[model samples]
Target: MNQNTKIYGLVLAGGHSRRMGTDKGLLHYHNKPQREFLYEQLQNICDAVFMSIRPEQQAELPRGFRHIVDENMYRGPLNGLLSAHHSFPEAAWLVVACDLPLVNEKILKYLLERRNKKAMATAFATRKTGLPEPLAAIWEPQGLRQAEIYMKTAASSCPRKFLLNVETTLVHPEDDLWVANANEPEEQQRLLAKLNII
Candidate 1:
């Protein structure tokens, strides 16, 4: 953890989950909801942790947890990320998506250890595709500012694409599966099998 930088954890849970037919964040992955699991993991490393959720999903959120409701009508993870930035512009956010069941403390620790504060953002590079995993990333204040500027443009609002064009530090994950995201029932089943639950 960089002492000079105030790092906060933002759990992206605002997704519609149309493909999963349910809220992926509410799914049980490690004897608890995935969102709760991730929130606890973030609590260990961050000064404060907040879950990014849509307004309608507020009733479904677990009690005693701090959250930021998305104010933007834009679709996708960008809405959550930007909303978080808007709420706390001074803090660098270690954003994590709820669907990443394989994400553990070890992976987050590694990310923090190797974080390049000088860069706009520090993210992991997928071993298979060699592309930046934007969701599991530490977005510095400057990076978030740039993202806000990019959002105003006519270009695509894909975070990965923004990472590709920015000054970001990307590192390879210790284990490929550590960054695996289960978005659908089949993917969740596969992850469950990998965890020896099936």
Candidate 2:
């Protein structure tokens, strides 16, 4: 890890959970809200932690937790990532989506330990599909800058696609469950069952 590039945590919670039919961030998975659980977990390792939310969500968050409202500058998770990047341009960000219930401290630590600063980003890739999981990856300052430029000419708003085309380091986690995302209602139920919460 480069001493100059500090790692800050950003929990992306601003998405419209239409498929889930409820706010995924507010879902109680580990006895607390899923987003808050991830936010607190990141506090243990990151220099600072923040939740990337929408403007309307600002009032919903409890005090003491730092938040950056999505500027809506870009699409998808990239909006939140860039908003945080714009706030602290020099620091690197360890980003996690709110829908991933299995993204615990161990998985986060694993990603951080394997971070390669020379690369644009150090992302977790699924062995099954060999696709990068941008939601649960570290975005270096340079990587974000490239992403910004990539967005300017690219029509696709997919973050994973950006990582796939860039000079990124792919890390395969020991457990694939660590990056499993609960996007729809069925997925939420299935993941909740896996967590023994259902």
> For this target, which candidate reaches the highest lDDT against the unseen true structure?
2
Instruction: Give all candidates' CA lDDT scores.
Output: 0.89, 0.92
lDDT of 2 at 165: 94
Question: How far out, in Å, is residue 107 in model 2?
Answer: 0.8
Give the per-residue lDDT of model 2 (tens digit) for 1-198: 456888999999999998889999999889999999999999999999999999999998999999999999898889999999999999999999999998899899999999999999999998887889999999999999999999888999899889989998999989788889898988888888888877
- Residue-wise lDDT of candidate 1 within 65-144, one digit each (tens)? 99999987455688999899988888899999998988877789899888888888999887888888999999998898
lDDT of 1 at 152: 82
After TM-score superposition, the amount by which residue 89's alpha carbon in candidate 1 deviates from its true location, in angstroms, is 0.4
> In model 2, how many backbone clashes occur?
0
lDDT of model 1 at residue 102?
85
Q: What is the lDDT for 43 in model 1?
A: 94
TM-score of 2: 0.97
* Residue pairs that clash (backbone atoms under 3 angstroms), model 1: none
Error of 1 at 163 (Å): 0.4
